[model samples]
Each structure stands twice: as structure tokens, then as C-alpha cells.
Target: MSQPPPPPPNQPPTPPQGGFGAPQDPPPQGGFGAPPPPPPGGFGAPTPPPGQPPAYGYPQAPQPPQTPPPGQPEGYGYPQAPQPPQTPPPGQPQGYGFPQAPGQPGPYPGQVPGQQPYGYGYPGAPVQQPAPPQGGGRKLSTQMQIIIAAAVAVVLIIAGGVWFAMGEDGGKGADAKGTTGTTGGGGKGGGGGGGTAADGPGKEKAPANTASKVAFQKPHPKVTYLTNVVGSWVTDKAYVKTGINSIVAYDLDKGTELWTIPLPGQVCAASRHTEGNRTAIAFEPAKATPPKNFQPCSEVGAIDLSTGKLLWSKSVTGGQGGDDKARFNEVTVGAGTVAAGGTDGGAAWDLATGKERWKPQVNAEQCYDMGYGGGAGLVAARKCGPYDQQYVIIQNLDPATGAPLSQFKMPTGVEYASVVSTKPLVVAADVGDSAGDGSGISDFFSIDEKTGKLKAKIAVDADRFAAECDVTEVESCIKVAVGNGRIYLPTEDHEGSGEYGQTNEIVSFELATGKPTSDKSDAGDRYSMFPLRMDGGNILAYKEPPYDKGGQIVSIDGATMKQTVLMENPGVESVRRAESSFSVGHSEMLFSGGRLFISEMMISEPSDSGVDDDQFYMIGYTTN
Candidate 1:
């Protein structure tokens, strides 16, 4: 059996019960929970040099504090108090630190009131109801539910695929001189050099100090079962996000709606990579009426992020009534090609004109493409053989023909595979249900992009690692990141080097040798940090706040591993609870140009408190 589950952490964020499409119990999978606190004390902070200006919004480093400011953390590196700490009113968790604003005032607009919807969120937040029924999939019979709940009892991600590793040697990746993504060439979607961070750290400037006040909170769009809200993209002028049956873009600084592109149905899958401001996505072709709440997830298309335009959307209907629209579980784009794949079949289209590149080639019973990963390159994950004895093939495809230019076969027992990095050629898998906690990772396999050869195998213990991957989606993985020739993952929340609460650190493993590196960064006491993504060679991570503290965004140097605090959210009650409400692994986080933005992956239905008590969609913070 895998390591036993850790005790439920104190004061978890509660969003809604539904995570992906299923509900989980305490210590919910992908939750933002920290261990119980040992009272509150002064946690260490990064202090600036005596005369030099401090980074971001951090106040000047603390000098010898002659006296204490009520409610403020009285210690080294803390900002001098402007006002005494606000009383948290009654029953509310005490907000840490001092006076971003004075004494407690009226309810902030974002506050959810007495009760909130059940969330697969930070633990302990009050929930109004038992987990609600999700929109799709068959229900578990009472007997199966009881038996399953008692046994594995992990997050049930029916949305994505798993990665693979064979025997002890493991495997590698694929890349050829192919075309797709933001490149001018619109076919043959293969090759590396597509990772967004392949360039440099974002141009986000530091504020006066590492403190913040909420810039804005986006009102929630009511949706049932908290479904169909997926994908977020940032453009030069707007923050684009996927909504219920539409794609919406809002002005970055102002919460103004820039534009909305309505779709006939809900989005089923969206690519993480955007090429030349355009990205690929899969959605249902028709809206659910009544008798049916889910349409076939068959249409694939590309969206121009800047203009909020659906460049083109088409479905496979076979030449002449040969088959119905082909359904897809995932879609991705790179080298100017948009590829979609699933149990139904695989297909690719030109991003520029929506012209068909190729039809599904592996439809025969022997093998079929389960999904495709695109960004640095396009690779088809093909499944073959009978149920009891199955294997997988990771193939770099020729965009125009959907044929393999290079390939790597995976071992048996590969239930699912999450493509971690396309160009660096890395894949992750639980192998044989080894990570019993639903984290979807047991090992990481780094493959040579050019030769499709396995470089090294890096094993992980799920209970000790904090990354997560969808069990069914080909590309949905979170917390773990790759860049600077290494894979970075956060350790499970453990006893901190500090006097109290649990914390975790981000550790790296060199891709070349699959060995641990000397470089590491801490989440500080009572905080847990996860690599958000790569900024050039740097790792941009989010530090989940402690119960009373605020969240933080930090940038870690690729070489020295020195961490620079980018933004520190306000410890004001509403903002603290609001920031804590967003699960780092389950939400969209964008920190750029000196601003930090986070939004829920899905918005829950109304809580017992009423529609007015619904959660917020997006929250923005700036150093300014």
C-alpha cells in the first residue's frame, strides 16, 4: 500500500465539492490546506539591505522594534505599522499583520456570508451541502460507492490521461523538423522550442513592498454543478478566460469586459499553449436541452486570444455518413497545427485556415491514438493490445499526415500518462496505481527530444510529493514544472524548519541524470509553495498562505536558486480568505507585469446562503 493519508490540515479553503468532475472527502485532492498551527509567531521574511529599496510591495526591513503594534507580527523584516491590526469581528479567523486598512468594517463584496458552496477547496471552509451531483458520467451504486470510498478514496479525475514508464529503464520523448503552433508554417506539428518559458522571466516589476490589496473581484457566472469553466490566457490587452458556453476577455487592470465569444456548447478541452495569440480547444457541438445535459464532445477549433474570435470550428463526420462526429478528450496546438484525440479517433487541422491535415489513422482495433500533446511539439499517445496486456506509444507526428516521425513504446500497466514537457521530452505516470492518493504520479521519465531515447527515471513517492495529474486527460498536470534542464516539484507539506505548522520546499532533479540537485527553495514556515510555471529559466511559484497570513508569489533564480518575493497579498480577513479560497493546483494563476491574477477553474452553483453568496470568478492584485 502507498503511504497512509496525512491528517486533515487546519483551516482548508472551501470552494465547491466538485473537482474536475468528481467529489472527494477531507484533505480533498488538489486542496490548499496546511498543517495545524502551533499558535502564531514571527515567521522569517526576506529583508532588503539597509539602504537598498526592498523588492516588490514589501515594506522596509524591520529595525529593532522598540514596541509592538497590536495584531501585527512583531518581528524582523516586517513593515512598520501604519495602523493597529483589525479585530476579526466575532467567529472569523484573526487576520494577521497590520493596517493595510484600519479597524474591521462592513462585509466586503466578495465575502460569501454564513455558508458557502461545498468546494474541492482548501480544507475546513464551511460547506452548505453534501457534495452535489456532477454533470456527466454514471453514478456509483451504493455498494460500489461504499467499497470504493473505504478503499482507495482518492480524487477521481475522469478528464485526462496518465504518463508511462517501463520496467526499470523508463523512456524518452519525440521531436522532428515539423510545423505548427505560432510558427508561420501551419502543418506538420512536431518539434521542440515551444515552451513559453524558453524565453525569459516575465517583466513583472516589484511593488513598494510585498504587500497587496485586492485590485478587483470578478462576479461569478452562475453555472450548475460547477462545470464547463476551464482555460485562461493572457494577452497584451486582456485576461481571457473560458466561461460556461463562451470565451470571455476582460480588461487587465479594470474589470471591464472586453469581448465575449459565444459557443454553441460547453468547452470540453483547451490547450495550455497559445501560439501567436491563438490556441486550440475541443467543445461539445450542441447545448444540452433537458433530457440530455451533455452533447458529444466532438468539435475542435482555435481561438484568437486577442480578438475573442473562434477562428474556425469543425467536426469529423466521415466523408459520407461513414461515421458521426469524432469525439475528443483533449486538444493541443504547436507548429501551427491544432490536434485533437481520444478513444473515438485523432485528427488535425491547420490553425490558419481550418483545413484538414489528416484523418484518424489508428482507428483499427490493434491501436488507436488516445490523445495528443502539443506545445513544444505534437505527439500522439497511442494505446495498443488487449485490456490485461496493454502498452503505449508516444509518437512525434508529421502534421500534414498524422504519421509518426519518431516513436517510443511504453511498458505495460500504463493506466494514464500526463505529458509534462513536450520539448524537453518528459512524461509522468503512476505506473501501476502506485500513488494511491490520486496524485497521478509515481515517476517522471525524461526523454531525449531529438532521438526519442530515455534519459533517466526519477521516482517519486506520492505522499511525499505535491504534484497532481488528471487520470484521463493527456495533458492536464499541475504543481510540477520543467525548465532550466530540470524538473521542479514541491515536497508534501511537512514539518517546517520553523517552530510550527507544516511547510514544503521546491526541489529540482536534473533532466540529464535524473538526480536531485543542490538547488532548492522553501515555502517558509506555515506556507506551501508549488512551481506555477517557468519564466525563462526561473520558476514562478505561488506560496499558499497560512490560516491568518496572506498568499505570496515568488520568482526563483534557475542557477543560484535565490528566491525573490514578487507579491504578498494582504492579510486582511476578506482578502486572506478570498486568496485562500483558490486552490493553487485547481485554479488559473497568472503573475506578470507586476500583477498577480487567480481564478477558479469552475464556479459553483448557489450556496444555501443564496445566489448573492456565490463565489467570485477572478481576483486581481498589483504591487501598485
Candidate 2:
């Protein structure tokens, strides 16, 4: 394939950038991504039509010259003139690809007709947005972000090139998929999916050649403000990802839209744990509107992943004086139960039928279950202690009764803990805020599930490991895997052996010994890799794209720590553009059965810049 043609002579130059505290030099001249000085005949050269567009903790690659289709804006990051929001064209089929006409009810009570199903929120009005940081600027339309990003693409080189779409808040909330599961990407890291026996390792057999092609892409559900889509899953029958308030399932191999489950309100959080094809999520009880756009994440629902269906939706009140509907921050499915935990304490329901098993537990200890980690096993992080001081108590719970089988109180000053694995019982936390990078993790604690005894505390520098977990979230850790008796994590990017650029590697630490291993898998010069989730006994990692290259998925041997490429994405500029745009530390990423899925944790509404182009909600790539 050839490089896209540059923009025409009438290109609108970007205005001076604002907000950087210190003065800086103008963009470099005569290098990759610099606006080209006109062709030999100068301004007379004809610019080809617009074309081009993909990373996460690794830096982003230089963007291709984004030629805007005629009439669209040319620069990115600047606000555009206000214009009326346009609904998707008629044939969109509820913002889907390879259409399935799933019938859903019309707008809710008081909702205006024709508003998007994803609920970009009263489409007739503009939503509030946080001001751009540092200097406080405005956003370029979500879809139009890349066109002018190319003009400044050279900056990514210094960044080492990965641009995970974490949104304005550093915490797109963490991966939260960090738990245990028996199927579908196995809840972050464990033995499940890829059809492997519980005792053995399995790798998705790659074609003799590992190259891949774009299977399909789902556009970002049009919304005028930032919205949390918040989920991703892979199953035997489908590839699932969220679109605003809707849950969509697509055929794993063909990318056909199998079904779409519409929600009454926006999804605030989703369980990474899947029991076969069933999962759950926490959503707002009602839709948000102009003046009261804020909705507490107060309701929980059980979902069937295989056949898109909303099994049930309900909420409860907390122990302390609280609203009739208690708000939850997390939800999980494990051992035949769907559990949700948050400010309102904790609640659980039978997955098969929405029968309530337990409501929020109230006590004088000022205790409550803040969140859970489930799937292969069920565990809860209970919060206790007085207002002056707070600490987390980890519990190995009986899924059916929500009773603690064993408990271990986290060390003082540890406000949050991510359950990396429930069966083996590993938890990660940023003790005393020691990890200053805002990644939310600095150490891993291995515990004995049966006795709740501490096995070892493996300390890792925030700068050394790629692992991340939102300090306020329990199952948010990503870039972590537990199996083969060890915990694995990608190392932070470092200068590579090449004359230029950067790279990183995957390293493991023994759960029993809490000792680092020499065993490592290199990402090669200019490339950086992150642990997505585990498949069977092997560690599945995503290699972030290097300049002029595309991303790759490799299976790392659990015992030998060696890697075998299973899928190598096409280096086609347009595809690369789409491939590199998800969150590395915070986004949902899954690879199994020769297919790879990546999605943003949350999507945003375009700014005043009404220019729309090719933004995505989820993207899938498949092998030959």
C-alpha cells in the first residue's frame, strides 16, 4: 500500500497552541509529520482526498497526513464553530456494523423521539465538559482528532509513541477485568477460553503466517459529552463491547452484528468476570438531562453475553442513611451469583434468576463491602474503620451466601486493592500513595486463600511496571496476569538497542517467593508490550505499534517466558491509525481464537467542533 497523499494548498494552518506554561519553539521543519512546504510548482499541486487513521502506555506512532474530506475541519484540538448535532444516517441500525435489527422500545418517558439509543444525553442540548488541562483549552471533535494530529506527529517520537485514549481523567477507571473467570478471556488473567483444559496451557494456533486484516470497526456512538461505555468481553460465540448505554455482541470471526441490548441508562461499570456467557453491569437508574446530568451509578443488571439480553435490573439501599437506590462502583459474576459493591455497601443476586441473595450489610464498625472480584472464585474488599482512618479488609467469600470464609485486613494507609486473582489470592495496591505516577499500584501481595495469610509482598516501582489500577476501584488492575505460580507485568518503556526510539519487555515475579525473575520477553526495538489477559496457562500480551508498524499479539510461554506471535496487524496507515487508539493501561483489550479486540473505556461527545469523521467504539482484527 502507498502512503496517503498530503493535503491541498488551501490547508488551514493550526492556530498557536496555548496552555504550556513555558514558551516553546515552533514545530520542527522538514521532518516526518511537519506540514510540507508546497510541491515544486508550489500551491498548484493537487491534494488527494482525505484518508488515514491506531496504542496504549507505549507511545503513539507518527500519524499519517490526515486529508479531511472536502468541507471538514483541517486541524485538531481546537474548538470548531457551534453547529446543530446531526443524528446518524438512517441505515446505521443503532450504530452497528454487519447489521442485526434487534427491536428495542422507543425513547423512555419524557425522552424526546429520535434521541440516540446510546443516550448521548438530551441531544438537543450541549453537555458540560472539563476544560482541557494545563492551559485550559477546548477539544477538537472526537472524530476529527487525528487530521491535524499528524502536523504534530513528531512529538510522539519523544513520547516513544503510544497514545492510549484514557480521556481527560488519568483514570478511565482501570481495566477492572483483573479477577478470575472460567471463560471469555478468563477475567483478566486465569485459565479460561482458547479452549484449554484447566490443567494445561493452550495457544490460539496462528496461521503459518501471523499477519491479519481489519475484520470490522464500530463507530463511537454519537454523544455530545464524555460518556462511560465501560466494558469488553470475548466469548465462544461472540465478541462483546459496550456502546454508550448499549451492550452489543458481534460474531467472533465474521464481525457480524449478532445482537444489541439497549439499556435504560448509561453503563457506569461492568464486571470483567463472565460465567460462561453471563455477565453483569452497574448503570444509572434514569437517564441524565441538561441540569441534572449527573446520575448515581445506582442500579445493577445481569446480562447474557452469548445472546444479548438484560436478565434483570435492580438496586438496594445502604447500611448508613442513604437513598432508596444505593450506588455501586463495581459488579462481578462468579459461582452462580451476580454481585455489586459500592458506597451503598454490597448486594448480590442469583445469576440464573434475579432472586436477591443479600442486600447491603450494615454494622457499627462503619463497615461495608466496597467492591468484588469474581468468576473462578468470589472475593470482596470490605471497607471498615472510623472516619478519621479507613482501611480495606479482603475476604474470601462463599459466593452463595456472601459470607466470609477467610479474611485479611490490608495494611494501614492502603485505601484500595485490586484483586489480581481470587483462587491464588493476589492483590495489588499503592501503599501510602507510594506510586506517584497516578497508575495506582506499587506492590503485589500474595495471600493464602484458605487461611487469608500473607505469603509475600512483592514491591515494584511505579516507574518499572506497566500495571495500573484506579485507586478507588477494586478490580481495575490491568497489565497483570497470575498463573504458573507467578505474577507477570510489562516493564515501562526504556531506550531500545536501536539508534533511535524505545521498547520494553514482560517480566515475572514468583508468587511464592516474591522474587523477580530473569525470565523476560522483549518487545523488540521501538515497540512496547502490555499484558492484555491470560489464555489458558500462557500469557497473552499486546505489543504497541512502533513507528511505521502495526500492533502484534504474542503468546508468552508460562514456564519458559518465550513469545510466539499469534496475530500481527497490518501496517497499513489507516488500519494502524485505528489499531493504536485504545487505552493500554485503562482500556479493555482481549485476544483469543485468532481474533483481537480493543476498546476505549469511555467515549466522549464531540466539542463545539461538529466535524465528524472516523471515531470508533470498538475495533476487531482477525488472522488469515
Candidate 3:
């Protein structure tokens, strides 16, 4: 992997040291050399007037021995050389009346070495010395006690100032490093939580009516059906499929098309998987001919999200004859591989170099549904046997090489409905429906993916399996999502009268116990919600009401079931009735790189003028 470039020269490489408002350095050390020699004529310079006892206050030279005055002390009367005053002890300061030798230690215990006492250096200054000890030691002067106390107070004030400054900068520093505690990589996609100044917490939510407040809108120039919308790792661009054969990259913020790539054939089905800067587009081609029973193409292709360029293409051949529709029905991208599976089997490719890594062996007699197993591996459901004795075999395969890691048969009487989730190992299937029609109650089974053993089973009402407005089969209405240790099932309310059209109620069940949880609330009663995907710890839901002219994209907390309206579309309304497959609104919505893209597909039959008409439009919004 390559390293990022160095910062610009004008920019500082690291944060400033010591933080702001720190104290300045203390004043330079004070002078401490011995005091200059006393000025001329001062105490030691010259003897005072002769009569003044030689300025030493000694009695005039003792009388030469005035013959002993009888009883006068014999020694005192004798001529004795004038004796000097008692000398002070070493390491003790001389008193005001005494003269001391140079280089002698001071009287104070903690005084600076070789420095004169403060009062001793100036003329006429009061010089108080420590009192001589009688039996006990002398005490420190009151003046000395005051000096020590003042020094301690100054030190404390400097320390407190430093501590307060660091506390203020700590929060800002973490945010600069993208450690805001909400999401990684700034909360792009339905992956995690993160935000900028405008989208972070405490900001007012976007208005419920946002059709006229759209930030950007772009329409397709050519007649094409919208397929999917993918975002760049940086959240700056959107890769949108205008049709199966063409994909256009648009500036997410500017609403301008950046680039477009055209594929080789009419696309039958497509899926997108993105990791970092790379996005894998796995699409199956449609066979031209009898429109009702179309055959699957022989190969699938991959494309680069940044450049809109084809990276590589691989063959997907295995099933029976030329008319056998063996095209990949499902395509998923994982950490290291891009996998595509259909009735024929499944194949995996290296994401970085587009090399074929592995292909799984399949029973030509069985039909399968494939999906990525939360980057852990590939998951599939294979159905085999006669209609009355049907059995669905579930397998977990190695992501690197298509080998089965675990396999188990669905409880005897049930047929695979769909792989609701692989992370929590939840599967939805139809129970006891031998006719192959999805009229029976749907059963949700939680399995131990590692051991391929059944953990729990819960039966859901049959009315919850009604079809979506655009699809005729009931199976299309049953959408399941798993996250935050729970399974979310969005089911249509079959009880409501036609006056209100169709509305969906999302029911959440605990993954560990298979029991309904209290997190479900009445907030979703007024609108129809479709499970999209999990965004961090929250579940992203698409809401459309029966007769309202606007719709809302809500994010429900997976743990608390607290609902937050993320975006609203005032101009987009649900189609009251399905006119045709192409006329259905709200085709698909995707959250990527902190942005959301919603698309609708519209198609018109050929007119008498021989001009075919088709229209596609995508709306974009910044989630952050």
C-alpha cells in the first residue's frame, strides 16, 4: 500500500507545544557575588579619631602599669595589650557592631552560597542577627518566615494555569483526527455513524417536505431504466445505473454528470458492492428472443467506480442447454472477493485484480439463491426434489475458495424463501406449501452458521407475505433485515380497507429467543415502511403513506426503536396502482458515503411515430 503525501511546507506538522496561554519563564537568577569592598573611610578603612578608642570602642590603651593600686586587680592594672572583641562563630552572620571576615558562611540555613544577606549590602540598613543560644538553639527571624511562604504560593499558581489549558484543547484535537465516537470514515453509507458541523447532533432536522427544497436533481438524457446508486468512498460522487447497459457517475454535491460507461449487452439483473475506492458491478446479460422466457448470458462483468472503466469480465457457464437461463441471479462483493450465483452455481473473483479465485459445484437439478455472508463467506439455498417432497439445502461457503464450510437441510417440510441475513444466520422460508406458490405462512429460522444447526423458528402470518405494488407475487413484499441482535420484518397490513391502500408495519423480533420485542411502536402505523439496510446501530427504513404526496426516509434505532426522519421527498408520491412494471415509483434507494440517492423508472410503449419513450431520474441528498 502507498503512503499519503507529506503536508505542505506552510502547514505545521504537529500541534503547538504547551498549549495556549501558558506562563512565561521566571526572571533570570539574581546576582549573588560577594558585596563590593566597603567604601573608603567606612568602618574598616582607617582608625577613627585617636581619642575615639581607635574606632573600636576599646578603652584607651591601658595605662602602662600605673603601679598596682594596692587591691586593684593585679592583671587589670598591668599593661595588657588591647584585646579584640569576641569573634563570632564560623557559619554565623556578624552582628551590627562586629566586623566579619570575607568568604564566611551566612547565618541563615538556606541562604545562597557566598551571597551577602539582603540588609548587609546597603548603608544604614537594619541588620538583625539570630540571637545567641543560652541552653537551647536560636530561632529564625519573623522576616525569614514570610519569605518562604510567598515562594510556595507562586509555584502553585503556575501549575494550575497549565492544567486548564490542556483540557480545553483535548476535545478539538480528537475531532480533527476523525475520532468523533459516532462513525468511522465520517459515517458514509449505511455502514456507521459520523457527521460534519451541519449534519451532527443538535442541528435541526431537514424539513418533512423537501421536494421543492432539493439540493440537486439530474435526469437521464436517454431512455433507460434506473438500477442502482453507489457512492464513492469519499462521499463526493454517486455511481448510478441509468439502465442495465449504461452507468453514469455524477457529482453528488453539484448535480453534474462526471462520467458514463456503457456495458456490452441488455442487462437482466445487477448488484453493486463497494470497498474503499473500488466498486464491483456484477451484472448478468439478457438473452434476446421470446420475451417471456429469456435465457441468461454466458458472462458477468466488473467496473471501476472512480473511472467508470471495465476492469474485467468472466464466464459463468455450468447448467444445461442453450435455453437454460443460467445467468447469475445474485451478485455480492465481500472483503476479498466478488461473487455471482445463479441456477448453474456460484463463482468468486479477487476484488483487486479481477482474477477468478474459485467456483462452487452445484447440482444441476437444484435452484439456488446466493448472497454475501457479511464478508465472512458466501451463503446459498439450494432446492431439490419433486414438488411434494421438496427440500432446501443451505450451505455456507469459504469466501476465498468456493468450498462448503457447513451445510444443513431446512426443517423437512419448508422451502427456502430468502436469505434474510447471514450475520445473525436468519432464513425465511415457506412451510408446507407443496404447490410451489407462496400462499402459506412464512417461517423464520435462526441457525448457528458455524455449525449449520437450527436454533429457533417463528411462524409469521400469511397476510404479511402480500406482494409489493409493482410485483404480482406475494413473496416480493416480505423484506427481512437483521442488525443489533434483532430481526426486522416489514409486512403489509392486510386488515386495512382499500380506502387507505397498502401500509406496512415493521415488527422486530429478538434474535436469541425468537420472540417479539417491545421496541415496535405506533410511529410506523401511519405509513408503509420497507427495510433498506442497517446503518451502524440503526436501521434505515423507506416510508410511503397510502394517499400522501410526499414520502420520508427514516432511521430507526435498532436497540431503542427511536425513529429519526432522515430525508423527505414532497414531489415523489407512491403510485396508487401499478399501471405497468416500468411505471412503478420508488424503484430503489441507497445510502453511501454519507449521501442518499433515490431513483424511479418509467417506460412508455412505442408510439405510432415509431419513437419509443422511457424516462429515469435520480434525486440526491447528503446524509451528513
- Model 2 lDDT per residue over 496-580, tens place: 5444556676766668867664345667656677787777777888877664567888886664455677888897657765665
What is candidate 1's lDDT per residue for 454-486, written digit by digit as tens? 898888877667899986877888898898778
Query: lDDT values of the candidates?
Result: 0.67, 0.69, 0.48
Which residues of candidate 2, in runs, are more than 4 Å off?
Answer: 1-199, 321-323, 608-614
Order of models, best TM-score first: 2, 1, 3
Cα-based RMSD of the predictions, in order? 23.5, 23.2, 30.9
Candidate closest to the true structure, highest lDDT: 2
TM-score list, all predictions? 0.67, 0.68, 0.55
For model 3, residues 1-624, the per-residue Cα lDDT tens digits are: 001112211112232357322343542344112244433544323434545544321212334446557766557547655778777688765865466555453353213344332111122223233343477556645444344334444454454444322222322321231111111111112211233211123222444443323446544444322233322222345545545356667777766777777765544434434565555554445423443434454466666777777778776444432334345655666656777665555667887777887654455555444434334345666667656776777777676776667877887766444565666677666666532434334567788878898777765655443222111111122245677666776655433222223344455555676655433422232355656666665667666533323455666655434466666544332221110112223355665544556554332232344222222355555544
Q: Kindly provide the TM-score of model 1 when superposed on the true structure, using C-alpha atoms.
A: 0.67
TM-score winner between candidates 1 and 3: 1
Task: Identify the runs in model 3 with alpha carbons over 4 angstroms from their true place.
Answer: 1-212, 215-235, 242-244, 282-295, 319-326, 360-376, 384-390, 434-441, 464-478, 494-504, 524-526, 546-548, 571-586, 592-595, 600-617, 621-624
lDDT of 2 at 256: 85
